[model samples]
Target: MTVYSSNVTRGLMLAAAFTAVVSRSSLRDLSSVSPIGYRIGFVTPQRLWTSSNSGRGSRPIGQIGQQHNGASWEEISNPKSSKTVKLFKAIHKANKSRRNEIGLTVAEGVRLVADLLSTENEHSKSLVRRVVISDALKQRAESPDGDQYHRELIYRLREADKKSRASRDKANAIIINTGGKDAVQACCGTVTSQGIAALVEIPTYNLDELSSEGEEEGFYLILDGLADPGNVGTICRSAVASGVRAVLLLESSCDPWSPKVVRASMGASFRLPVIEVPGDNALDRISDALKIDPKRIFAATMESSGDAGASKAHFDVDFTARPSAIILGREGEGLRPKIREALSNGRISSVHVPMSDGVESLNAAVCASIICFERCRQFAQKKSDDL
Candidate 1:
């Protein structure tokens, strides 16, 4: 007697299969059936209502009891359900361009959701559109060790629902209890759910907003055509750690929302402004966005001299003087001609890490981390001196 709105395709099938039951049964009784229940009762071909009638004293036709698994639960066992298919596509689709068309990203693992919960801000909680919880994790929630963040996740789910009532499209957050491990694997294809994963709204960002903030003392990290997700993620993590105001990804850079990048970022992406600048006059756009002179920006490179500028040792640059940006180019090719031109003209200074005779260069991420910390060190010293 599960009453699925005609919207649920399976419910339509069930309704079609048992037209006689709908004739006599009350809609209220049929609607009472929990969507999570294993079996639903309906009239047999003989036109008799299902369920035992002898001891029950002729219970109402199509009457259903509350589901044992509890309320507000929908079990998604079919791998082909539209909902399941949509989730699978969002989780597995790795191409950045395609993901942009859909505008949603999958964030898996309990630790990531825990990081979201730690923020305790309404906007952060609202970003979570759905949280998929596996039955195994639900059972484990009864134990001390396995229950970490489980209750908090559930709480956030309720909070989302509560906020949804107050605002339009603010919180579409749903807590899905996929009643089996196989179902969880199907959703994420992971050996384990780590308890839960969320499909969150990847927050939108613009360069102007990033540039406007901390104008007097901003530190912006610009990834110029860098394609490595791990490098991008770690650099973002370091950017936040070293007090950067924002992180900008050039149009050619890897998608910050990719699962690998999001995972490697360790939740720092959510904490900072990570934006994409279109390749058309990209540097010009950045220059226009900033309140300070474009000359404050510096480009990091491997060689002492490029097509344009002569590189200076990292420490020679004065990061503490004003709001500035550090540009890290692709892993091997270094900066493009226009970027190098900016460097050569003294608009964008080139900074390189000092290396031993044998060492050519460090990994892109490592170099970024080193320079970010150096900037942090300078800022720390400046703060101390002012005191």
Candidate 2:
């Protein structure tokens, strides 16, 4: 018989209604009584035993099968909260798979439930279609891996809700909503489960506003003309593999935070910082930011009066000798002179993968991988030399 715990408020209110069932002699054959079901808390092992019989006292909460459609799903019952109700429906639709597969995507942590309330995308608003959180399990998420990294993650979740309304609106465009009530808490738990999202879009950043930041000591990949989402996404992955800590995109570059880019990065976009600057002074702005010597800045192009001419093998450059950055040109046009000129006085330099006589050059991301690994390999070699 379908049974419910006393914790299920709606069901408990109906207990008087349940007590009436026992009087019907027609229901004497224990199994003959209709199974009573209600939207209630999960049944624990102890509660499971009690449920087999027909008693009417409170039972302790316990872990059992959690429906994916969720228990604490609160429909927008109050007419005053119409917006919230719409969102509930949308989330239910988006999470259909998790509900079907796991029968347990609905989390039980309070903080996780809180996070679910903060959905800030358009698509997500649709998801908060009208569902409410039904139950929050008492168990909480662990304290992250440790002190340092743990704080950073907490900061991301807390700060994500406080950002501009404009940004939160972008979240409304997708199935990713957080910063709300019941369903919102569910949403936050769903994404944070991975310990990291594959791609997290800065909902507010337009091409004009994205800015790059990095250590003065390591390399960053400056994507010039690689606008294709697939190419941008792959290069993001390549950046991480090659040990590049960040990605700097030119004005003409594709939005790295776009859904396409997010999907393509396969999650590197979350781990790597991506920034953008205006197209007019793209190179000029980068020079001003990292603030490393102009001579150390390297562009991925060959030009007259360029550093590539004087440099040793792309692999031969003393990567460990000083801090550096790699600047990639358009997928086809290569780096413009303005780009090369921006670094002539700075610590920036340039590198080119030598073609074995015929092939013109590699794809932007591929070329970036070669340059990045060469530099990383150089750094590793330098450390060994020091030891």
Best by lDDT: 1
Stretches of candidate 2 off by over 4 Å are 1-216, 302-308, 340-348
RMSD of 2: 18.6
- Over 316-336, each residue of candidate 2 has an lDDT whose tens digit, in order, gives 566665456777787777776
Evaluate all candidate structures by whole-model CA lDDT and list the values in order. 0.62, 0.45
Span of ten consecutive residues with least summed lDDT in model 1? 39-48
Worst 10 residues of 2 by lDDT: 44-53
Query: Which candidate leads in TM-score?
Result: 1
